[model samples]
Target: MSSFDAEALERAAKAARELESSKHVKAAVELSKREQNVKVREYDARKAEASADAEKAKAAQIQIAAEERRKTIAFERKAKEELMSRQQQMERQRMREQDQLSRQREQDMLEAKKQADMERDARRLQMEQQIQEERLEGARRRAEAERANIRARAMAEAEGRILEQRKNEDIHARDIQRRSEAKAAELRGAIQEAFSQLSSTLGSYIKDSTALRNTVFVGTALAVGVYGVREGSRVIGRVVERRLLTPALVRETSRTAGTFGLRQRMKRALGMLPAEEVGLDGIVLEDKLSSRIVETASATTNTRRNGAPFRHMLFYGPPGTGKTMVAKRLARTSGLDYAVMSGGDIGPLGKDGVTELHKLLDWGETSKRGLLLFIDEADAFLSSRSRSAMSEDHRNALNALLYRTGEASRSLMLVLATNRPGDLDAAVTDRVDDAVLFGLPDAAGREALVRVYFEKFVVRAGEDAPRRLMGLLPAARASKIEIGEGFTDEYFAELAARTAGFSGRAISKLMLGVQGAVYGRGEPTLTLEIMEDVVQRKLAEFDERRRLAKTDYTDSASEAVTGTAADAAARRSSA
Candidate 1:
């Protein structure tokens, strides 16, 4: 276009060229400006969009923070409500506890007041009692004072009567004395006249030889007579001794002749045979003690002490504890003659007791195999000189016994049995080589005693059958008892334990009682129930006896009086 417009260009070329250049420049500038403006607008749009995004993010963050704060506040509020609810419950509980404490305190105060009232009442009653007692005492004192005054008046009257009686007796004595002196002077004058006549007659007789011959004859006769009298006295002594001391034939009231050795001879005559003698084997002593005793017996038999076959033994215990039985058994076992005497009886005989003791010792010495002298109830007479009532006779008898005991004789093995050995003289105890305590049958001893007694007691086929206590096991097993139950060993043992205080004698008596009951009832067997009844009665009786024995009558009287007084006072107070 420019080429074509060359002619036209000549005319307007400069104008065109300038105009075109200007236009081009303008377009370039415009283009440049548009591009710059577009860039700036895009930058402004991006900035606005970023600013909006920032604003939205800030709004979201604020919402989130507000949500968190709301949740924390809600949680804190819930916790505060819970804390307040717990506090309220605790406050209510505290109030309830305080109310309970208040009630408790009130109850305590009420109880304290109640106890105080009771104590006050008791104190008041005690004070009243004391005051009443004091009043009674004062009345008693007044009565005693009045009685004393009356007694004084009576004593003065009695003294005056005694003095008047003495004066009358003195006057009567003087009158009698004067009369007696006159009689004496008359009697003396008569005696002097008779004596002068006898002297004159004697002088006449002395001048004769016939008188001298008569005197010689009389002297010779008197000497012979004196010799005969002394010889007669010796014969009488021998006869008395043989009859009383040397153990002669003693005629009983039935005229039956029996050897009179000692008082215990009667017992010996009825004692069991030597072969049948009961040893410790059949007894219910402790194994240690029984065995020791059995062993001692055996050993003594095989041994000898100081040339004697055995030594002295003492059996001390309660009565009926088999002491005598043991002693007899010892004698049998030791091959010695058993002789016994009651020291208690000796106490009653006085001087005769000494003679009896000497006789016993002499008799024992004469035994071929030796003798075992058992003095039962020895403490009765052999009590200490200081501890017991002593008289000249008793002392002499005790001395005789001591002398006899002291002389060691191979023939004498003296055994003393006493319930109270402590009461025995020290000298008597000193002679005891061995001492054994026969304590009340323990469980074992009781059991043994029961068996022994039962074994001996023959169980009859019928209660009506003649009752014999010698029933042995053979007889028992031989005849089936028609009774409800025969005695069992176990039952007997138990009965023994139940009969705690029963001695061998008591047990024997109990069995006898049972036998009596059975005999009356006509029962065949000794039933446990029957035995139980018997034991109950026996124990009750035993307790009563013990109480009575220990009770002092004076003390009982005082107690009765006091009790009566107190009861009367109480009755009066109640009225």
Candidate 2:
């Protein structure tokens, strides 16, 4: 029963347990085969013992013992051989795993070297790019320095030449002064001699004709007084023109094209200063279309494919929606020289309209500053040529416009504004680069316009700004129309909301009406009720105008239909 015996099942079971714990599947399988072989040998031993007993022969028993010994030796040899074979196979497998691990490590090392080389090459390229950039920057700086030095030298030379010319001018001026004084003295002597002769003749007339002497004396005295007055007025006129008008015009001119044309001076007299007209601010930008057009024009003014600015644009919208205002802003924000003319003004010139239109285009081109020619109510003259009512005058003007608007001149932009875009000739629309629509303001726009009008017309222009900007005054100026304290931005917003269909002009007019109503009554401040009453009146007026326009359109269409039917009947009767 000792486990030391080869036939013990406990010994085989211990070996099997050890093999399972070792977790070598191949070794476990070989142990299981050996266990089966042992079972077969035990069975063979039992069978041989049974056969010996059945025969009851001693020789047979002895033979069976010898055979069993031989089989034990063979079984021992086979087990030893299998153990050696399993050990050799395990050794070979372990070496293969070690070799695979070593190869993996070598591959990882090689990949690391490749990544390091790539990083080094990238760093080298980056350093080279930096060095090249530095060199280019240094070269640009040196070139700028050289240009500045050259400009300095040229300016110095110009200044020296200017100084020499000024000295020469001074000497020439002195010579001219001497000659002028001499001529003045000679003229004075001649005037004295002529006056003495005239006095002698008048005295003889008095002595010879006593009846007419008093009348002649009075006439001579009156003539001398009139002559003195005329000369004095002439001198004053020259002084006023030189001292007052010239400097005033010069100051105003500095803001414009450096000098004023006669027409521009006339325009200034009519209270249309270009700078003031284009000086609108945030409130004017409440309309999205207007602001977008203004912003687009300003942004693209200096854009370049190769090189070019914004070309021509068309502004079409309802009346009082600020087409002309947007055009002026576009011209101003782009810093272009602005010229304004109306199509209505041009149409009255008959055949001369074409000439005047060409003159305008020529003037714009002649001024080196870029020109923005804005024509308001353009449909008046730019009407379709195919229309029955197209006058010869408008036809000629349109032809000239087509010629001038071919390709925009150097930095010249033509802006046309029309309340009736459908009336505009196809040729005009085709020449225009961009057309922006400006419709009536919505709620926000109305409120902004109201605020702008109130602030501009009532607050600032009236007397209230004195209190707001410089603290409360002792008394308002006599000319000031004071704004009531109750009328605030909220009041304006409410009034604006009520004014649903009113244009900007109508809102401004409402302000004007309130001012008139308040000022005529001699009230120092305007009440909110007064403002509301004025707004109601304006709204009524606006409604009336709309109704009239609709009625007029309906009447005209019906008349056209009636006239056409009558004409057709007349033609049938004639047939």
Per-candidate TM-scores read 0.47, 0.46
Tens-place lDDT per residue, model 1, 341-383, is: 7776776777777776776577556666666777888888788
The per-model lDDT (C-alpha) reads: 0.69, 0.69
How many residue pairs clash per model?
A: 4, 0
Q: List the residue pairs that clash in candidate 1.
A: 284-445, 458-471, 483-524, 483-525
**For candidate 1, what is the TM-score?**
0.47
User: How far out, in Å, is residue 447 in model 2?
Assistant: 1.3
- Give lDDT tens digits, candidate 2, residues 162-223: 99988799798999999999999999999999999999987877777765877889999999
Question: Which segments of model 2 are wrong by more than 4 Å?
Answer: 1-280, 303-309, 462-478, 488-490, 550-575
**Model 2 per-residue lDDT at 215:** 80
